[model samples]
Target chain A: MGGLTVMQALAAKLPGERFLYLGDTARLPYGTKSADTVRRYALQAAHALTDHGVKLVVIACNTASVGLPYLQEALAPMPVIGVIEPGAAAALAVAPNGPIGVIATEGTVKGGAYVRAIHAHSTAPVVQQACPLFVPMAEEGLTDGPIAEAVAHRYLDPLMARLPKPKVLVLGCTHYPALKGVITRVVGPEVTLVDSAAITANAVERLLDEKGLRATEKPGEHHFYCTDAPDRFARVGEIFFGNPIDPGAVEQVDLQ
Target chain B: MGGLTVMQALAAKLPGERFLYLGDTARLPYGTKSADTVRRYALQAAHALTDHGVKLVVIACNTASVGLPYLQEALAPMPVIGVIEPGAAAALAVAPNGPIGVIATEGTVKGGAYVRAIHAHSTAPVVQQACPLFVPMAEEGLTDGPIAEAVAHRYLDPLMARLPKPKVLVLGCTHYPALKGVITRVVGPEVTLVDSAAITANAVERLLDEKGLRATEKPGEHHFYCTDAPDRFARVGEIFFGNPIDPGAVEQVDLQ
Candidate 1:
């Protein structure tokens, strides 16, 4: 479902580029699962995309992004990108000095992908917090009320209280964007929020331009696929995608 | 993870019965998946349990309970029980009159298993509200405090305003038991809360006694298995199970 947000970003950035989205809804929420399990599922999903003959594969999900290296190795010669690097670079571009905050799911935080990615470029102090409830809250569409604000405060107050204070707060998880309103209020006005979806879209656009792989077509069609619950995906997915998902366009597929 | 609560209930009721528990942690939160996908996973899990030579099978999950009949048919002649029926029976036993309420995940509520199960015995009015956020809240250990109370009010206030007003509220999902305190406060003292875990345990106990299948052994061993993240299963699982899980006892298995 979070991938829908990235897909929308990609669509906005490169209008003529086609997209084939595969949501592992059946075994969703790779966020809380083990790294090994997430890696295996990510590989399987990437394989499905590779079989579809796409020019590049963007792992829109931050948790799944932890397996980018393994995915790049497994699908040799094919260009693959994950949200973490672009997000990390984007955060550093705005706040190159020190104290960057990252809020993602448990798996993403545990994987330390964002922290490592940021450190690879700069020695800025990175603070990470896992907001497990944000995904469900976002999905439930309780974006800004008392409950959302309360939960956000609970997760972010400590992160905000850290020494030096974070100038940039990375919305590392795609789902986090939905709760942006409450998150902004919780983090206050000083923090510049970085949305990985848009930044990753920018990264993909740059890569495509550099590689001369930009689409020449006037427009492109969007194809949606999931492992299960096409109806719910097409419905709730509209919240993330910011567009109505045609029920007929959503197809269900099984992955080994 | 919710199944762990049910497992704890079963262990309490049948101390002499050995158990083989499987947590489909890799593809958990079945609450949101389609019935077909959940049914397929349930069948696979049941097959794994059947191979272990268990005398009876209990579908501890309310969402997976939607496939109880199919599971019972698939594993014919093997006694099978689902939480929904037992939960509904218990709800009716307490509130024989009309206007009973049920709170569960989206899939479980959409399945209308509780409504059908309750109506199977009487013509009572079954009001159901899908509390999708409760599962994550419970898992995150935010079962109390202002946030919990706020979320409970958000979900329950509408149900409480119903025409007849539900006299008995059934906690249809296993994860719900953890939020019993907040939920009790929300529904007030006038409403009776039916815990599916305890009721299902009683049903299983009765079935075992009637069939002369109660274990003669003095004590029983509990084996915990999951598709992924044994460490997490032992850690977060303690919140649901109400007991510290042995890290060494947790084993990871693969499901087809």
Candidate 2:
């Protein structure tokens, strides 16, 4: 579900671009693993995608983006893009000066990637809040309503209590966008919610144009690959995409 | 933390027994995966455990135990023990008849292993509740608090509302023991909570004794292996084990 926003970006910004998505279903929630481990898995997956000969590699997952350097190095000469930088940019644009908030999974928050990214942007007070439950709730398709609201309130209250509370909150984890309504309600009217996927997609489009690698004018075709359980992947993909997915092009791959 | 209960049992009940525990830190939270994929991963892990020359394979994870038949079949001649049957037996002992509840990960409950096991004991009405968020909370060591209580109340409410509600509730997942206090408070009086790990360990003891495979009177040394991220595993193990652990003993093995 963390890739939903990225997928949406694929549709909106680069409608004619072909995408090859590989979901490491066997080793999901990479947000819970150590830095080195995340890098290794991300490299493995990037290699799998490269086997298909992709032109650009997008780390659609915020968790996997924790290992952006490894992914980039593993796929050298090919362009590598990650969600963190785009989200950090959006936060900087919105807050500009001080007091911005970041919400992500425990690993992503603990990895300090977004915090580091934002700090590199400006000295804006960045509060990293890990809403561990949001990922499961989003996967359950419990995106909106009282349950999401309650959970959001609990996680955001501490971040909100600071003097001159955050005016811009980055949906640091892609999954956070799924719970946007509830999260927006919890954070109240003052904060601008930055959508990382949209910003990252814009970046991708810019990269393609700059590299002069834009595809010929034709509708794009995309394929999906999962390390394990294509059926479960489809079920989850349907929830994230908010529609019934076509399973025809989906394949279950064993990443060595 | 899936094997925390089993490890606890190993230390207290079979102090003389040698154990080799494997936590598949890579493909974790097997609760959300398809049955076939779980079987594949569990088999790979079992093969790794067998390489240590251990006499037994205990599927310490309740969620992984859903694939026990696969593990037992793959590793025949060497015995394989799972937690579901033991937990069901404990539930039967507490309630004796109808109206029992079972709380586990979505995979374990949805697998219907507990229902099948409990049905063999008695034709009890088993309510299988998947408090998926509880595992993450427990891993974070947020066992008892307003957040835990609120989550517990939300998840336990429907089970509590059942007419002449379940008199006995089985803590189906090993991780459930960490949330025992909050769960107990939510389920309230008149309901008995059955711990699956304790019961499973007792079953393991009986099996070894019957097979004449019981170790001689000497405290035996043990080892721990993880498919990935041994450092993260050690950190989480400390939280579950409630003490600092020796990271030197934790080996990260790639079970290909």
Candidate 3:
């Protein structure tokens, strides 16, 4: 999913902040990368966002958030928030007693970011499944149909096979939020799906409010920039943002 | 998949030709954008490939290949080959008499690349469905499980429900080749599956040999680059090209 969608969702949830999103569409899905590499990319992205004069930079990409320390260090003065911590906190808040499940890309799952965050707060046995395909499925807009269901099952069966299934599941990647319906069905009515994006959005709102840096009046200008083609980002940005977003304003930027 | 994977695969099929692949993993999966946008991205990618000093540039992404004329115009002087034409040719060769089904990202299906290519050579009716999620699934390495199957069915049901069961199905995207098993099951035993990568590999071999541009002796360096984090591409590259693959060679590139 693109950053615009996350920003849009965050804007709707908080309603007081001016957001400028730069989706690294040219170089997307940091999910498969190493922590060091993700950190570097996140740092670059953070610099871009801060340069746009955003009050606070939100590391919307879960991969980047999982490796947030580097990003935090990279953006020394600007406040940055990631989805992992907030989502972990939210999951721990409501699910103190249940088995917590986390599904994300192989890299995110391998990073043990959610597991670490969850373990810090609760004693629930965290079950993790690398639902790598969920991102592409969501990006392709395969939310609820038969194909989506099949893909969901393909990734879910192994996790479900383990005894004492997880009662609380973390949709670790931002892209996975789009697959909530199919994921919910596959896990059955027993599981509580926690979307990290929603939690992250809430965290952004809270951070902005606490810092007293909310953008109040004007409908802020959103200049979409991607390392890749702006045109491609615009088309897919609509799907990612959960709306029909136009790419007319997007300007392609080189992130060297 | 990396050009390294393509080179390795084609090395056996084509024999003794030097292969250079520019995956554009930094700006991957050109399947969700508009025709013009895809063409532009393809041109940029082609220029990168051309700059590598290769005799030909393969628009490996099916989505970009569908916008061939525009790409052709954009990357003039350099002989360009797209996956769509070769894949279509292979599908027709196998099922000249029966209906052919194509599953790809929205852009590919919408562009009618496969349909147009196949129709040019054979009388067989072509059935197309936009399986946009398949790429993410494959990239994430979730091809074997219930999730993969579910996603496949989600895309297939609508297409299968309407069209006659195809004797051949084209795996238009490089990522889709990894999903051959899941797709085969969904499409059934009767349908033949054609992978665009395989066709492109063979085509590249043929073209290089015909032009005396095949590498002479030593294996060429397969330097991978991405606009995003190279580590993610490297990890996924392991799934595609096998483990023990070196990501140290994945350089960070700016594609603006």
Candidate 4:
């Protein structure tokens, strides 16, 4: 539901930093497609972001993180960070022991990036589920109703029923954090919800500080761009960011 | 559910003709997107199809029909058919007068192609409703269940309650034919459901025959191509086509 998860994280954590956010609404929800297509779309989106001459970029989307290397290569010397690593690290820290359950978009789950990343940190049996409908449900703003609960139960029931019960449920898709209440209720009180947005925000802060690329501007202004459907971005942007984005500030650009 | 609606219609109608079908499984369901994005994608898809040396191109999708002129211009002298004209023609034929109901994707409905086409034929009030979830529902194979009925009732109830009730309800999206049973029940026996697939197939037949492009050969071969994720196409493709498609036979092509 909240497509601007990482952007919100960085914007909130780094008040002095200016951002040129680009949403590839044209080929969005890249969570369900093949690896090759996601990689291609990610590169195109990264190119659009860098075209604005921003000093730093964040692949706020977990699915698009697969093409981080390509983006870094293309925009060398300019810093770029992806959400997956930060998310995995956060999940491991949250649950030092026991099984970890990860719910993400179809592509991220199918890509097994989270599973592999989690394995590197801990020996817990990481269960990954692709809740494709969660994105649509989140976009519709049905965060805690019967429909959202039913959908949550549909995806979380099996993960909770594993032999080694998962103590930490990583909300891999950014939109998922909106359904946190419903997800938490379904998974019960014993499970901790790890949001990638907060984790990535912390990572962005650390990376910027360590690299000596910190900015000192106060109340930084942000501009938004989209590959297609700027109107949709302006309309739905409020759901992601609590504040309404000015329609005039959100412009459409050709990513091709 | 009937992803191959138009193609299935053509396959059934013209058994002796060779067909090469390309499903843009990567960036699909163009019904909710902006006109510019849809036009660009349609052009890319059409160009991919023509690369295979096909004699004619058919835009079975109502949403992509807007890009027909662009496709025609790009591949001049090659025959092309869009589902909109055929669907509108079929509806007018079934209901020579009065209000005509059209249900399709958001892009197709908002594009107002049906309204213009219907007005060109009859002075009847054209009622167009955008059923954005129908495509997802159809793809999920929830065609005739309670969920499908509920969705159908939700969309068709308003159209059915019109002053001059719609006599013929055009199933604008290709995938909509699968939901016909539910739509028919909701609209009652008084209303006729016009399927774009059948109409477009007949139009294709007429166009081919008039141009003397009919083949006398027996057992025509069919080829399938996808821009990305052939596995998804082959899986959901079974609902569209009554038979299962061999994944090996389905080739992946780069549209870019």
- A1-256: candidate 1 lDDT, tens digit per residue: 8988999999998888989999999998999998999999999999988898999999999999989999999998899999999999999998997699999999999999998999998999999999999998888888987888888999999999998899999998999999988888888888999998988899999999988888889355778889998898898899999999999989999998
Model-by-model DockQ, in order: 0.88, 0.59, 0.34, 0.46
- Candidate 2: the clashing residue pairs are none
**Which regions of candidate 2 fall more than 4 Å away from where they truly are?**
none
Task: Provide all candidates' interface root-mean-square deviations.
Answer: 0.7, 2.0, 4.1, 2.2
Give the alpha carbon lDDT tens digit for every residue of A1-256 in model 4: 2547777878899999988888888777687788889888878877777777777788888888877888789779888898888888887887866588999988898888888887887886788888877776667676776656766787789999997788898899888888888998899988888898989989989999999888987535688988778888888878987778999898888877
Tens digits of per-residue lDDT for model 3, A1-256: 5455467778678665555778776556777666765676777777887777666778787777865777677677678788889878877876786577788877688899988888887778888888766676566565787766766777788888777877778888888777778888998988788887677787887787888877677466556677766766777777767666567777777665
Docking class of 3: acceptable
Judged by TM-score, which candidate is best?
Answer: 1
Highest-DockQ candidate: 1
Where does candidate 1 chain A have its weakest 10-residue lDDT segment?
A216-225
Q: Which digits, one per residue and each the tens of the lDDT, describe model 2 over residues A44-108?
A: 88899899888999999888898888777767889999999988998898888968888888788
lDDT of 3 at A184: 86
Chain B TM-score of every predicted model: 0.98, 0.96, 0.89, 0.96
Q: Write the per-residue lDDT of candidate 1 for residues B103-219, one digit (tens) a residue.
A: 999999999999999888999989999999999988889899999999999999999999889999999999999999999999999999999888889999999999989997845
Candidate 4 stretches greater than 4 Å from native: A69-77, A142-144, A163-165, A218-220, B1-3, B144-146, B184-190, B218-220
Regions of model 1 farther than 4 Å from truth: A218-220, B218-220
